[model samples]
Target: MAKTVLVINSGSSSIKYQLVDLESGEGLASGLVEKIGEPSDGHYKHEFNGEKHELEEPIPDHEVGLKRVLGFFEEYGPSLKNSGIVAVGHRVVQGGSVFPKPALVTDKTIAQVKNLAVLAPLHNGPEATGAEVMRALLPDTPQVFVFDSSFFFQLPKYASTYALNKEIADQYHIRRYGAHGTSHEYVGSQVPDLIGKPAEGLKQIVLHIGNGASASAQISGKPVETSMGLTPLEGLVMGGRTGDIDPAVVFHLIRNAHMSVDELDTLFNKHSGLMGMTGHGDMREIHKMIAAGDENAKLALDVYVHRIVGYIGNYAAQMGGVDVITFTAGVGENDEIVRRMVAHKLSPFGVKLDEKKNDTRSKEPRIISEPDSKITLCIIPTNEELSIARQSATIADQGDSYGNTFTK
Candidate 1:
């Protein structure tokens, strides 16, 4: 019986999970529970051994949804009880400053995570709900929380701090708690090995470009600077996010447009970015519009690429120099145009993209930069679920005493 870890990412209305083999680093099974607590019947899909099984039924809550998930595993292929499952890992989006690394799920920790929901109202609450449901449903299995902001928790004060009033900032804990850290950490860790270099003093920049994108600068595998700030909305222009916008725009909208805080929030977070510019958020669709000579689409592409290039240069300067630059996540891994534009823009920094190499589509990590290029450019697919599983398995093996031990 091979040991495995179940990784769960609980969204507001969905629960995405994967059963990963601990020794092989392979996802043995994966599934999604969707439309949870919705008016219509919720959907459940489970995939294992290359077969997919789906169910459509009312799932009023995370508890009911997760119960159906366990039932599916038993009915389909992998029996949870016989699969040598060691731990259940939950992805918590906003651990805030409370969790610097993955923490074992407990009554107190669950409360702490829920308390931090003030910071991530849309994410943390539901993630905590999933954890609570899983802990109760599988009391024998160790439950671990892998935070998306954990990697940037130890960022240098200058990088994490905003120049806000000291007393107010301290009172509110306003600082850059970057998101997409699990992906960054996982991709950053792969750079040294992929580049055949030592991790001792390597300076690397990880561009995690997806629907919600972010960039990070790491030294010796630790984050020093990242694009995302106090909230995920303060960084790179994303699918529908305004990214680095002037704060006064909020006040202006409130006063001039008579918009409420909720309306402004919706505007910046859900209606801005590429979507706001071209009425499309997906990069592929934007590219199609650009081909049809849509000025808005062209401008949106330029803006997106411009923000990414700016961050690469900024991270390089902040780290003194960059040894390796890796692109990961959805757009980062698949979008050759974005990668090409960014590399071309960075040509002044001796960043050269090999046209043929960049054009080649590969699922495996490969170099897309020329050999003589000053900085190494490569594409490394990120596996956040596998990362979460590995971390959770390590902590689970530390015995029953592993409580709040933060990974340094």
Candidate 2:
């Protein structure tokens, strides 16, 4: 009879979901539906109570894919009909500057989010579609949108603004609205818990590296600067993104290569990054190629870690000093080599990652720095869904803004 929250992360071709009991901080069920509407095949994979279930079916659209997810809940376990779901929290990739906190989804809010699609076409459009479907299916259920960009809304103006014509920039709403905010906020807050100190005393740098990666510098539990800019593609070199590139390259590709705007978009957003450099995006595959003496993979790994290391050093200076450095997300949490390589290079900066702790495979948060290092290093696995659920529940319960976010 415990109350729960259903969290949904809608992607262009996938929906990642979880049902959790907030009080227990335990996920009751979670799964993903991939390749939805793909001409070849669609897949549904679900996990409950340590068991896995999968199915293949022609899911023609997002609605069907969503239905399949709920169906799996019924077929597997933790039937939603009796789970007492208080709210459904959706992870929206871009909320623009309009929303500084999780929003109670309404028709008006949906329209507002749709208008912001221009800033995140690959994400907002699809997310809006999924929201529409969820509304139609669960008309009476209270739904909240947890934006990935909201946590960076208060980034220092100097860090968020670009050196451009303020008039034109303001008109176009062009500013550094960093993404992966939930992860950054969650990890930053958890650092105090991991290190047994109050958050107010911590100046921490959080690395949320995955297929898409970003870095955030949080001072006194708030973001001062972050790597991702106006869009996700502007940050670290990701699995398929050309990050930190010269803007003129777009014009060059369009004029010199005779590529259209859409082609260049796909090229930079989809065909670039690790795969573009080394022909594979998954880190595990890249490691295999590296072991086989693939120079491209080796260079890719170097380039990847180099971006991360540079950001850590820059953040340390930007914050005047750093007390802790934390890693989260896919690569930061699991890739032992990545953590070690970055830490080894940062030894001069008081980042002495303990070899044994760095290699520990457990997902629990723990310090990875040497006992005598001046700066602390640890791993805090991000739970964005739970963060969203907590935010949503808090808002629904008393309309209180969790200290994690602030407005201009």
Candidate 3:
């Protein structure tokens, strides 16, 4: 019988989950529940095989949403009971530096994660609550946490450090701890497979753009630099988070506008970004408005692509030159317009796009570069959850770091 792994990604307003057969790395079921604690009406979407189902049920809490997910397995999981699930993997948004890798969940670990809640106010607190609820509801299940920061730990001192007093930096553990690490790791690992050369000897840039966006440059298969700094708000402009803003803007607002710290925090982290520049943050909506000749929508698209192009150049320069460039996440993989525009901007560096290859989407890795392009361009759909599941299984089955390293 094949062992299974359940991966959970809990957010402030929803819970996303997937059940996969570890032996084959195939998803048996995946779903999400949205609008927690809102009006009595909410949405639950589940997909299995080729079928999708939806429910208009109230999910007032993460615990309730979790229970619904378990219920789905009870009703639809094929060979689920007979094939014992070996472990559960959780996508913990903030792991800080306390635990560098996926760890078997314990009360002590939970406490430690909670203590770092202040560092990731928007994520760790609620994520820990969901983990706690999981431990209570499924006491017998072995669990592991896969951090989004783990992959960036390899950043060199020069790339990771901020120009501050070394003493203060060490005291607060302040550094460029990049986010979306699981995705970065997955893509980095696959570069060798896709290009048929060792990733260890190449320098590449990875763009992970969805609701949250980030960029990282990998030197010799390790993260050498990334856009997101101490927090998720420091990188390329995202759906809502203001990225790379002037520091003086905060003090200016406080002194000139009399805004409190809390108010300023909420404004930048929540109300800014593409949504701040334009009323809508969804790229699809922005594209529609652009087609209808809205100058603001066109401007937003220009700014977004420009920001991405700027980072590609910066990372390329930082790493000397990029051998391979990849685009993943929602906009990166599916939005041909954005992909083409970004690739065009990088043409100066010998990056070329094969329009025919980029217009299609598939599970398999596809080359989006022209045959004679100097640098390779690829569209790789990221699988962060699968990467987490793989990590969890390795730790559970091997029981030691030496054995765990084999799988990687």
TM-scores for all candidates? 0.97, 0.95, 0.93
Candidate 3 contains a number of clashing pairs equal to 0
The model with the greatest lDDT is 1
Candidate 1 per-residue lDDT, tens place, 1-408, comes to: 899999999999999999999899999999999998899999999999999999999999999999999999999979999999999999988988888878888888899999999898889899999999998899888889889999999899999999999999999999999999999999998888888999999999999999999999999999999999888998899999999988998888899999998999899999999899989889999999999999989999999999888888889899999999999999999999999999999899898899999998999998999999999999999999999999898877773333554331
> Higher-TM-score candidate among 2 and 3?
2
Query: lDDT at 40 for candidate 2?
Result: 70
- Candidate order by TM-score, decreasing, is 1, 2, 3
Model 2, span 1-408: residue lDDT tens: 888989998888999999989889789999999998789789999999999999988889999999878888888988888888877888888988888888877777788888999999878877877878877777766777889999999898899999999999999999999999999998898888778988885799999999999999998899999999888998799999988899999888878899998898888888899989998889999999999999999999999999898898899899999999888999999999999998889887676778887887997999989888989989998999889999877665554343222111
Please provide the root mean square deviation of candidate 3 (C-alpha atoms, Å).
3.0
lDDT of 2 at 13: 92
Candidate 2 least-lDDT 10 residues: 399-408
Q: Model 3 TM-score?
A: 0.93
Provide the global lDDT of candidate 3 against the true structure: 0.83
Each candidate's lDDT (Cα)? 0.91, 0.87, 0.83
Off by over 4 Å in 1: 399-408
